[model samples]
Target: MSKHVDLPDLIPVFPLPGALLLPRARMPLHIFEPRYLAMIDDALGTKERLIGMIQPNEVPGKKAGGVHRIGCVGRITQFSETEDGRYMITLTGLSRYRARDEVEGFTPYRRFNVNWDGFDGDMGPTERDTGFDRPKFLDLLGRFFSARELNTDWDTLKEADDELLINSLSMLLDFEPEDKQALLEAPSLSTRRETLVTLIEFALRSDGSGDMMQ
Candidate 1:
């Protein structure tokens, strides 16, 4: 089944070159670039302050901020203009999209023509019995804290629901650009959860930070 939605003609987006937004996750961004400032301006002038969150391929070049194919569209749930004209906005992701074409801009930002006519992706089942040998996903998180010697409240960490747990882990993990892009491009939530588990397991075996494999 496909979940078809009427996307706005002009969606405000912030391009984060290497990061991906899983469905239903909230990404808080600090907007400082001039082009993005123009984007915020354009969005605030319209009814929907929805911005597509996409990642650039590399940095420090003319097209340094060129984006990946897939990205998530998010609504500005919380925002405030800073004293220095920067926008601190929290984006609540609504759906993912594939870039159709690129738009030329005089500013330092890039925009894409998105195709989101039929968005069918869903967060799959998370309660299935895998019957694996390793500890629960929450325990792996605890192991991550201990292995990295980082301090966090384990009780709260353990209490987070599966979606929150996985999304939070994805945001905090040190994943490669392509690996992170793969996670973003995952068709469903269960797949992203599984990928995070695999990443955690790999990190456990390789002394803390290790390469994330697809």
Candidate 2:
């Protein structure tokens, strides 16, 4: 079965730091700001129902804070409105995109002209032949979790496939914004797993200072 949707030349962008959305991964977002609330409303009315999630640059006094070139487009799967006019929505990732151009101030929210050529593979099944050192990684994760007192479901974690484990952990873990972007931009699942392991190790070694993990 093929899952296909029309790829638009232009798309609405949500610039958030440390929020990573990989293809086939679902990310939940809270839309409270007037601009992003408008974004969600527009997406609901559109045929594609897509929104681009990109990381913003680290800089002071910048509007939209400058977004990264690469991003992932996700379809709004579920949404509910609060009495305060805020929206709670879950985005099901469809594909990854690279920004060829950005159009800011065109709307209350941000918009971008995206090219999806490089990440065509993201929509397909991730490679699993390379294998993962699950036990070793799990041991490291155990240490990190113990230090932070974060609970873990050993059964579920052990049963998850490589792609799910790698992508989900990368998104869930509290790495720096740039570190999260690095995981999002990883060329392959294999590399992402490696990067994630390195990040966890680095975080464990840190002394309460936020350092960008490689």
Candidate 3:
């Protein structure tokens, strides 16, 4: 993260269910909706080119889902417009924020007033997971993937550093929205790793029982 770059108090938010973007990670997004396409265009014109990635909460009585309080702010690092007028963009996570309030706006997409108090650490170096048990975690991951029949580059995953490996899995895994939110809200990398392990274990235990572990 650049020391000179300042995060905006107000930012456009993309409420995607089950999407997780952590600091120092990159997320590729395909923007086909008119509102989000407009958001991409507007973001490109800004200096920071920032957009907040948040998950929607499933409200029982509400017709539309409510946005989660916590989210990650990412800068538009790579972008290209397709022939069909859709956008293919990659966002590099900068910091995590807590939404203070939703700002009523005329822009098709939602915007929020966010606070970046406890997440200053997110702007720093990649967090080191001191207690990360690589062998154990990888073994669990392999079984979990096998049960789900999900294919991955084992060599690349083995070669990845602690932060990269954990964050990448947290993003790539087919966890439920609530599980992803829990992982996103985890205060430390180690905590997130533990939460991930638990989620995977639960999925594996529930596999083929028709219980449909989220």
**TM-score per candidate:** 0.79, 0.90, 0.94
Q: Rank the candidates by TM-score, best first.
A: 3, 2, 1
Please give the CA lDDT of all the candidate structures.
0.68, 0.86, 0.90
List clashing residue pairs in candidate 2: none
Candidate 1 vs candidate 2: which has greater lDDT?
2
Q: Write the per-residue lDDT of candidate 3 for residues 47-143, one digit (tens) a residue.
A: 9999999999878988675888999999999999899999999999999999888888689999999999888789998899998878888888888
lDDT of 3: 0.90
Task: Identify the runs in model 3 with alpha carbons over 4 angstroms from their true place.
Answer: 62-65, 208-214
Cα lDDT tens digits, model 1, 1-214, are 2234346544555666556676677877888888888887776676666788887766465565557777888767788999999989887767778877777665455667787755554322332223332246656667776788888777776666766766767876777777788777765557777777786777777884553322
Could you tell me how far off, in angstroms, the CA of residue 89 lies in candidate 3 after the best superposition?
0.2
Better of 1 and 3 by TM-score: 3
Name the 10 consecutive residues with the lowest summed lDDT in model 2: 205-214
Tell me which residue pairs clash in candidate 1: 12-51, 13-52, 16-55, 17-55, 17-56
Model 1 poorest ten-residue lDDT run:
124-133
Say which candidate scores most in lDDT: 3
Candidate 2 lDDT tens digits, 123-165 = 7876572667788788888888877889989899999988888
